[model samples]
Target: MAARKIHTLIVGAGQAGIAMSEHLSAVQLPHLVLEKARIAEAWRSHRWDSLVANGPAWHDRFPGLAFPDTDPDAFVAKDKVADYFEAYAAQIKAPVRCGVEVLKVERGPGGRGFRIDTTDGLYEADNVVVATGAFQKPLIPQVIPADAGFLQLHSSQYRNPDQLPDGGVLVVGAGSSGVQIADELNQAGRKVYLAVGPHDRPPRSYRGRDFVWWLGVLGKWDLQTPAAGAEHVTIAVSGAQGGRTIDFRRLAGEGITLVGRSGAYQNGHMAFADDLARNLDRGDANYLSLLREADAYIARHGLDLPPEPEAHVIIADPECVSRPVRDLDLRAAGIGTVIWAVGFERDYSWLEVDAFDAAGKPVHQRGVSKEPGIYFLGLPWQSRRGSSFIWGVWYDARHVADQIVTQGRYTAYDQSARARQAAPESAIHAAAGDPDGPYPHPHL
Candidate 1:
């Protein structure tokens, strides 16, 4: 196509990207979704055969449509999710360009809108929505000492427990990934070791009630306004409120050994944090506080809820190795496989914008950034419950797309325009403090 300026451009064709495209379509806004890889590439690349949606099918659906599976509690396989995304893209006829990698997104020279440079070509748009999820890169903690003998693999690369070596497996991080991997290994008849950390222990549902039901009732998941900063803590079902826990007790009952935080794994032994329980307690408190706040909201709103009682966590560690990784020697014990299921971190090196914080994340509120016309979607806890999940992208997509529509025609910043209305040089004062401070420092 020739050099044509578009109304809006959404990067990524995954769930979030497609959802955003649908919202734009609804508003009759002209837009295109540029996908770096094939649609739902994340799900396609998950070669694991046993991968399933940790939650139910009814809850794992995208906006305006539901997965056509019968099992509500059944886990949707990776390939199926990918297929669903493809079908979704087709169903909505989302204007998507596949195999187009966005190399850079920045203010076009004079701030006239965003210049999106891709591998295939270049396009200009009034607004850009980066719906890339947070799982772009795997995060491996530096605390663990590197050794020549041990093979380290992040959870993203792992597919099945049979791929592991003959020795016992050391699974780091006790979140969903950690617990699930450890459970699979143990079920495979291997001596599995899981490292416990602060996590939610919510039941999939309470008394035939989906957890979101309670959230909806409480209005905790209904945060529509933009937050000033990130949430310090989240609720966990695994604490004293046992009902919501992810059934870790059942895993322990099945012979999976749980342990404290893994410190540094040098020669062999892994040292764990001495105050593991204390740390967990603090995390649990934060989670409970969030839940209480949600409950308060429901009560105040007069949400009609059943008289079903709330459940708490039942802490169990039958095969738990409470010692830290630094104190345990795996080399001597013949534990050769090390699965780092800690989690993923976002890396924004490719995003050439000036609004990024020290952590390399784009600073924004309600999908809008200080950098005009730049927005983000599908971020973890971006808004409320649906922020990070596959089903939650539509909410953000609609909100951001609406912004673009309301903004009307976009104007790129030009040098001549800046020169005409530019403020005096003395008017721009320098900062007197550290450059690495919270907000961007104009003074150097």
Candidate 2:
């Protein structure tokens, strides 16, 4: 069958895809957004029921659409976030096809464009934009024993305390997701064990203003490098009850047992690292660094702002920090549930292109792929540290759309020589699905 040709074909109808569609529409470009599931599927299905956006509503607005003035400072709930995307799509009349999953994307005939094989049908596009945001796949360490007799769940599958078994729960990785889930489980009368990892514990509010406001004012949000923004660790804060800080020490005091990083699980025994104090110290250092930078920025700008508030005192138990459990028997400890909040993996296996790096990550500068007529949006550090967030998509999307408009339509062979010269054989092999390649399927 003949493929339906399009000027630009965008994959994933999440925030990034929707934002890209809006920009393309503004420029009067012909484009269509194809989503594997419904629009905002991740927010609607993947997130927990009680999950609220880590950022406030005011900071979550996309281009040409602002959150209703009802509660700009409020943290939008999962359902509300999905609704916002739906409403934005309606308002913009975005051309989005939900439930259309792209199975594979390869060089089109004669390398003139891309041939996209989707569940519905084939699509030929002069240009293609991958707008699938970060966090494509849930990452569970391989060290976790599959036979470990416990109800294991990743943060993506965890919904509420009631959904878990009626027993103690061990929440691994003390990032935003881990801490929040631990807090919720503890509040629901479940004995909670939090495996603390290296994480930032920034205050929810500083100097009578939300921390987000400080980040924006201090130019933290504008940081181009991921290193400067401390993108490694998730921001530990909550939007529940307006906004509140998430302190490990506070959770520990509230009867939540804190352990060190997880190591391995074998023979019904889970091993944990004994670097809790060191990790906490590192997090404290990062927090101080950010505060100092913010303070310096305020002084440099000579902005009239209130003095920084005193740091909150969180008393930690020495026993909790010193006690080392090299191996823990889950069944003996009565821990029936294990929640892995470790991290996420990005997958671009469907994209058959030579514009990937040794790590299987796309090689792009400010959202424009090295390969002509291809682009990526909504990736962390794609252009700025905020690139993966809702508020950040607009900037990257606009840049990508502009690139498409400037480059016009062309075949892949036009730049095949340059791509071959620039990209390594390993990247090409990985993209072409060489079984012996460094990056195999299901991971990338």
Candidate 3:
């Protein structure tokens, strides 16, 4: 294939990339998106078959579009969510080329722009936006031996309970994915053992409103990253069974054994951290904090939302999980599979740029990197806490698009184009200095 030049090039066609494409197309910016797989491939292929989105459809969709023929409060099934992305791309007429795998991104000839080498052909672009997102590589710890008799799989590789071997299953990690899988497997009549860890236990719905709405109304969604050393954690909310709070005590009551964090696995015996009770206490505290904050907000604002008498009531921990259980022999317990629902990290091996630090993480203020003409999207805490959600990506992408459109020579080109077209998208510039400070230094 012959080489070509494009004004802007975006990698990855997931929600983040698609949202970026939407904003770029708004100002008639010439750009194209290159995707290694089909649009929203993560939702279509990677997620478990029985999985539904963690948030309600109403709050989870991009602003310009809504889930078709679905209730706003309903948690959308995984495949339908993927369909929504595909439909959105078609609706916006996003310039996407699927199956074009980008291999490397290096400086263009004469150091002018970026040269992207792909499986299809080579191309040059004046600007590049890396939108592959933060969930690039699965982090599977080396606790279990490679030659271990039990089958091990990362949560990304898991499809359903049927995919696991016939025996007890141990699910490590207590995040959203871990709890959901454990619940699914338990419902299938499989003996499931879950390993608990640090997590937020916010109720899915409180006082007749979804927790998501409460976050936005209470202004918790716009939270910035805490000063370094406060480890980032995720909420353990679930949308299964019509969405509700996650309680380990209740799960233990239902016959699923809850254990502490997983440790070493040697000679068929698996060790665990003796912190299950402490982890539960931490989650309980987070849950109570939200309830109290909601009450205070309601009183201060004089809102007419209903109140529950038992909103602040937390049940006692079940006896089985009140204290950490000691080590158990995997073979004796008949545990045949281990699902590592730990987490993921970003992979920038293909990115040949100097915008990263010694830790291999991107060094950027907001989405704008230190390297000129390069940007990133779909990163956690990119702008705020909401940056990880679908609706949040809208604002982050808009900001990046603003910086790109108002960039060096492109500003002049954009001004002339707007004059000729007789429609100026001046709002992008107007909000550049808005007080929320989602992007502290747009120029930087």
Candidate 4:
């Protein structure tokens, strides 16, 4: 006889999974969370020791829990954040099977539910949620020449400055991670170079208030409404601002050298783009101008704001090489480390659903997909500003969880086989290009 089927199966056991589990328990929904590793694996394994969330602690809590800290503006370190997740999972007694990797999911035969095959075992569920976040894949550009002799590592593998070779270090991305790592390494007495890019810029503090406070004030943290339709659009556009995050202006003001986008490794020296330094300087100027404009607008709106804070307190070291990689030979120059602070990519090979549109993202309004009993969370822009953050997932999770309870009951999803058969072939045909195309079409 076939094994008993589960009611719901949620992929991943991180913050998003916990949020979904909390809601499922409240509604007494039968479900289980499948995690390939221990809970908070990414936080535990990938992040550096001194790393704290760029956002404040209060803004980092998941659903149904709060981060206890005397200083609201305090940055919660990586280990602490990991512990918080573990505690949250334990507190809720979330139904999770750790170390269980889900390899595939497909529509069940007869359309009753779904067939989920994992590394550990196989199971079926009426509904499934791919809560795995977009960070599953690390992205590196192929444009960089392969012959660059320097050792290159993604930020994921970086723990501290001690791993660098005897020579200087070159960081290839100037995003939040890149900037922070560059600062840390530079402080550790290693020669560091930062490659700058166009990133969102905000102040460390604005009007004597933490950046997160403005987010709350701006209703960026509001999640009472189910994010669907236009509300979703509003959230995306607003959140893309990175919550007006604090930039590295203060650091740069202290004399850190910033370069441009392109870099090549040659005889022991890293060569940067011809326009890298100039572009970086221009970008920095543009960023300051934008902030000043916002400040001016605030004053114009008759807002009683305190005097503007002085510019940044720290600056990077100035004793840096000037030539680009093409001009300098990296191997001969003995540059030991190359840090790829490049961004992440989204991978969804395990999901066996027809919901994804072009570019391999599930087509969902809010968290619900066109396929019944299917949902997603922790996406880059699931609904609003906080969708991807720990705190943000709570709102999206609650909405998606409630949706599952309301639409995922056994009776609600009990489509009759005959009715499913009579349905048009259009639905299944649309999935033809999908790797898990609805072959033997299970319609119910």
Candidate 5:
């Protein structure tokens, strides 16, 4: 059978791909979205059962619509997020084919367009938007002993406390997931040990606003990716308990023992770093930075809002973080389970394109890859700090779709970009209707 042809093919049905579909459809552009599972599979299947969106409902959505009948400050449950994406996709009339997994994506015969191999069948497309999102595979460090006798799982696979064996639980990585899971297990009367790391601890609410509101007000979400060292630091904010602040000392006083970073494992013992205080301090610094920024913004604008006393009250590091536990004997601690929440890394090995860098990450200029007819969406810091957030991903998805529509290159925006590239560097600036030489597509 001849390969199915599409003008534009999208390889995800999450927020990014769905948003891209909406933009393309708005302009009457023909496209189809393909997903390995149903829309927003990660939200539906990967996350823990009791998990809620890290962002509140008001901000955790596409620009076109607000979450249905949900309060602005409410942190919608994980299932609701999936429902929102599905509803949004339906509302947009996005043509998505579920259970269709793309096995491989390679250049078509004679280097024209793309040949996609999928479980359903073959497809050829003029352009492909790889919107598989940033969280492709879970990253579980090899810190667990090879012959450990404890039940272990990644945060993605964790459900409720009852899903694991009854004894103590050790939750690794101090990011949002780590903290929340540890807290939940601790609350359930389970002995919980949390492996802390360098993380950003911001209050859920400051003054009269949610922290997300402050981020938008202060323009932190739109800030460009920071320099090397701090770009990948874990953000440890929670939307639990009606969006309360995350205080390590409070957590410690409540019974969750915080340990330093986990390293190697040997002889029924897990070695932990002695830098717990340093990690907590760094997170505390991030916490304080937001307060100061908010204080300055309020004073500058002469806003009526006053500082939130609870948000400003600085708490000292808990006892455990100060004098870190060096080695934890699994048996002695009665820890029967380990939840690894170390985050994820991208996996695009199936995409047979020469558009990746040395570390196998996509190389793109504002979502448009150097490789013609190829694009990426929902990557961390793709354009700014909020690139991975729901709203940011939608924002980015539109830009990518715009690039496709404007450039009209391979599928013909006459992809004047190629002709421009071939033209003499001197002729680039003077090209008709293209005042800018270097970056011709400036939708910004």
Candidate 6:
């Protein structure tokens, strides 16, 4: 079959793609969004049944749509988030084709456009935008022993405690997911063990306001830094408790055993590093740094806000301290399940282009790729610290849409000028059907 031609071809149907589509439609540009699965597939299938968005509903709104009348501070559940994306797409009349898994994307013939091969069919486009997001693949450690006599699952695959056998649960990695899952398992009457790592534990609320509000007021989301490394920390917050901090010390007090970072699994035993205390201290320091920055920003702006509230104290038990376990016998300890919540990585192997750095990451300037007519969206630190968040994608998408429209107009004008130059004056006059010669419009 002949390949379909599109003006703008957008990949993915999540917040990024939807935002881009909305912007493109606003500018009266024709575009098509292709999704490998349903809209918001990650939020629908990868998250746990009870999982909720990390941010409040009010803060998670994308361009041209806001959350329905509800508790603004409430964390939206996964199913509701998925539904919101679906409703937003329908509301905007986004031209999205679901279940169209893209196999490869490369330069088209003669280097005039992009060639996209997908499950649906071959598609050629003048402009291509990648909105697949940074967290495309789960990062599981290569050192995890395959023969270990226990069920191991990534946090993405874990739904609830009932999925595991009746035994102690070992949660490797103490980021938000790891800590939250450990807390859930502990509450479910199972012995839960959390492996401590370097993390940032920010307070959920301060001065009678949610931390997210403070971030907005202080313009934290606008700050742009380098991309996060593999060991990037997370805010220790829980959606279950109305977006409150999941205090590790409180979890330890509730009888959840805390161990250091997992080193390796060998001979039915797991080795742990001896840096739990240091990790905890680093987390505390990071929280303090954030608070200091907020306070300084408030003072600098001379805003008459409420006085700072007294700091909440978290008491960590000695058992949860830096105790190095050279070897932890899983069988003897009766631990039957291991949950790896390390993190996620992006895989761009399907993108056949020379627009990546040595690190295999796309080379882009504020969502605009180095390659002409190619762009990226929904990446952490792509344009700002919040670029990866739902609220932030709108800015990047709008910018990309403007670039596409401007470039498209310029290309059209260039082609029209070339055509006029190639045609004879008599032919041009005949084509114009006017006594005066046909001159291009100034704007064109």
The candidate that achieves the highest TM-score relative to the unseen native structure:
5
RMSD of candidates 1 onward, in order = 9.5, 9.9, 6.9, 9.1, 4.9, 3.3
lDDT of 6 by residue, 1-444 (tens): 899999999999999999999999998999999999999899988887788888888787885667786588888888888999999999999999998998999999999899999999999999899999887888878766667568888899899989899999889988778887888899989988889888878777665567777778777788878435623665576667676766676778888888888987778888888877878787888677767777776789887767664554546545556444547888888899989888887798998987889998889889889888889999888887788788899888998888887787678768766897898998766757854334433343
lDDT of 1 by residue, 1-444 (tens): 644578888888888899999998998988889887899888877435566665456767775667775566555777888888899999999999998898988788676778888887788987888887777888777755565577788888888877777888888877666766676688888887777765554444654556655555656566764344434223333211122355544666777656677776555568776645554555555445545655565568776755334444435434342433336677775678888877777866767877678878778887877677788888876776657666666777788777766555322224323543565554323321435422322221
Which residue runs of candidate 5 sit more than 4 Å off their true CA positions? 409-444
| Per-candidate local distance difference test | 0.69, 0.82, 0.87, 0.68, 0.87, 0.83
Worst 10 residues of 2 by lDDT: 435-444
lDDT of 5 at 440: 41
Better of 3 and 6 by lDDT: 3
lDDT of 5 by residue, 110-175 (tens): 998899999999999988999998889888777676467888898988988999998999999988
lDDT score, candidate 4: 0.68
Error of 3 at 192 (Å): 1.4
Name the TM-score of candidate 6. Answer: 0.91
Q: How accurate is candidate 6 locally (lDDT)?
A: 0.83
lDDT of 4 by residue, 53-103 (tens): 777666667645667653555677777788888889899999889999999
Q: What stretches of model 3 exceed 4 Å from their correct place?
A: 227-229, 410-444
The candidate 6 region of ten consecutive residues with least summed lDDT is: 435-444
Which ranking of candidates, highest TM-score first? 5, 3, 6, 2, 1, 4
